[model samples]
Target: MPELPEVETTRRGIAPHVDAARVTELIVREHRLRWPIPPELAEHVTDQPLLALERRAKYLLFRFPAGTLIVHLGMSGTLRALTEAFPPEKHDHVDIVFDNGRRLRFRDPRRFGAVLWQNGNPLTHPLLAALGPEPLSDDFSADHLAAQLARRQSAVKQVIMDNHIVVGVGNIYASESLFRARVDPRRAAASLSRIEIENLTKSVKETLADAIAQGGSTLRDFVDSDGREGYFLLQCYAYGREGEPCRVCGTTIQQIRQGQRATYFCPSCQH
Candidate 1:
């Protein structure tokens, strides 16, 4: 699945082509996604000018005069900006063609992504209303994290990964951040000291900024809207390095499963 960095990269890539451009058409090739593509999506967004583009967590928000177009790049979904007509591949699900002939194409092999239309405040949308603060925003601070994790018995990794605590700290980033912070993935969130919490918070920000700078890690099918693979995978320290030498310490790295997701760490480096 595309995480925060990948999604943010996509938003930046497609913004110039679509922002302030009128939506001449909205095409839905597959309406049966994680949520049905709103039946009236095409009708609703047809002639509206896209005022701006923004991303919340993993969802893409295309602002318009009427409402916002909410897009979730689910498990195998990707979005691209196309300048010319290319043959749609097998899973090419939707296209928002601009009046200028640019199209924002969405492809999802698993059909788990969604393209929904909403009127009024998008932040209040059901899918977005309950989401936690954006990880890259000022609202997500060490003080905020410490307050949330004060008495939680969940693992520190798990707590950070929880959308309720803070959005966009996915599996890969979580493991990398925890390793950088020298915090064991299995450590209780409540057991963390103020210094540890501050370190963890800084690690999270730096890890994500690096990933975004590298255009995000290409796990499986992730690519920027420009259709380029992210280079961050080559910079990983502990993720996917089971039995490999740790970058910080000479000890071999290890991998374990926490909440069904692979967790990697350096036993000697992470306490």
Candidate 2:
């Protein structure tokens, strides 16, 4: 699954080419996506200029005067900016061609991705209305999360992973952030002290920012808009290093199943 960093990377990569460009045509090779690409999508955005391209959580918003085009990459999707002569691959589902002969291509093999139209304020849309503060936003502070978790009995990892508490803390990032903060994944959310919560917050921010800079980790099908795999996987500490020697301590890292997800931690280093 492409997380926040990967989506942000895609936004940055295609923004320069697509933003402010006038849409000449929209080609839907396959409309049967996760949500069945909005039927009137092609007709709606035909001659409109792309006002802006921004990312909210895991979805990308292509803003125009009338409305916004919302895109979610689901589990395995890639967006690429290409020239007219660029060859389309097997799974290329849609394309937004500009007047300049450039196109933004969307490829998703699993078809779990979506392309929807919004005629009103995108933030107020039901899909995005209740989402929590962006993890990178100034509003997502330690105090903010601490207050949200004060009475929650859920595991600290699960609490942070909750979209209502803070958006974009996916499974990969949750494990990495907890490992960096030296917090056990199974620790109760309400049991955290102020200091521990502060450390966890900082670790989450740093981990996400670093991953974004690195173009996101390519553990599976994730890739940058340019089709290059991310290099951050080479620097993972404990996420998938089960039974391996801990990077900080000499103890062997252990793996456990929590909520049916594999969690990795150092027995001696992470309390």
Candidate 3:
């Protein structure tokens, strides 16, 4: 699945071509996604100039006068800008064609992505209304994380990965952040001290900022809107480095399963 950094990367990569451009078309080759594509999405957005392009969590918000179009690049999904109308391939699902002959195409092999229309305040939409603060925002400070993690018996790794605690800290980022903070993934969330929380908060921000800067980790065919593969995985300290020497301490990086997702950490470096 595309994480926050990958989604943000897509938003930044495509905004230059689509922002303020009038929608000439909204083509949906397949309506069966994580949610059904609203049948009237084209009628609702056609002719409206996109006011802005923003990202909330992993969803891309296409702002327009009438409303907003919410797009989620699910597992194996990608949105790319095309200068011309390339013939749709097997997984090519939707297209947002612009008046300038440019096109924004969506392809999802797993059909778990979404394109939904929302009127009024898009933030109030069910899919978004309850989301936690962005990890990069000031609202997600150490105090905030400490309050949320208080008395929670779950592992610190799983707690940080919770969407309600802080948005967009997915599996890869959670592991990397914990590794950076030198916190053991299996440690109880409530066992963390203030200093540990401070370090963890900083690590989350730094890891995510670094991932966004590096274009995000390309796991299983992920690419930016411009079709560029992210190489952040190559720089990872723990994720997918199982049995490899730790970059920081030369101890073999270990991988364990948490909540059915892979968790990687350094035994000597992380307590």
Candidate 4:
């Protein structure tokens, strides 16, 4: 799944081509996605200009006067910007044609990505309404995390990964952030001290920002709009280096299952 950084990277990559560009047409070859692409999608935005491009959580927002087009690049989806009208591939499900002759192609082999419409404020839409503050926003502070963690007995990693607690800290990032904070992934959320919480908050921010700068980790199908693979995986310290030597310590990185997801850490470096 494309996490915050990967999603943000995609937003940045395609915004230049799509922003302020009038949509000539929106063609949905496959209506069944993470959610069915709105039937009236083309009716509303066919000739309207995209006013702005934004991201809330992992969803991309294409703002226009009529409404906002929200997109979620689920498990194995990519929205690529095309310089020319290239023929669609086997998995290419949606295409947004621009008046300028450029294109935005959405391809998802697993068919889990979404293209939905929301009137008024897209943030107020049900899918995004309950989402917590962005991990990079001022609303997400140590105090906020502490307040959320005060009563939770779940593992710290699991708690931070909760979308209601803080958005964007997915499984990969939770592991990286916990490793950077020097906290064990198995530590109870309530067991973290004030200092640990502060460090964890900072670590989360740093880890995410670094990943975004590196174009996000390409662990699976993630790629920028240009079809470029991310290089952050090479900089990973723990996420997928199980049984390998830890970067900070000589201890071998270990992996365990938490909530059915892999959690990697260095036993010696993290408590």
Worst-scoring 10-residue span by lDDT in model 4: 32-41
lDDT of 4 by residue, 197-230 (tens): 9999999999999999999988777898999998
**How many clashes does the backbone of model 1 have?**
0
Listed in order, each prediction's TM-score against the native is 0.98, 0.97, 0.99, 0.98
Candidate 4: the clashing residue pairs are: none
Relative to the unseen true structure, what is the C-alpha lDDT of residue 232 in candidate 4, on a scale of 0 to 100? 81
Top-scoring candidate (lDDT): 3
Q: Per-candidate RMSD vs. true structure?
A: 0.8, 1.0, 0.7, 0.8
Q: Candidate 3, residues 1-271: lDDT per residue as tens digits? A: 8999999999999999987899998899999999999999999999999999999999999999999999999999999999999899999999999998889999999999999999988999998999999999999999999999899999999999988889999999999999999999999999999999999999999999999999999899899999999878989999999999999999999999999999999999999
Steric clash pairs (candidate 3):
none
Clashes of each: 0, 0, 0, 0
Ranking by lDDT: 3, 4, 1, 2
Better of 1 and 2 by lDDT: 1
The local lDDT score (0 to 100) that residue 107 gets in candidate 2 is: 96
Cα shift from native, residue 139, model 3 (Å): 0.4
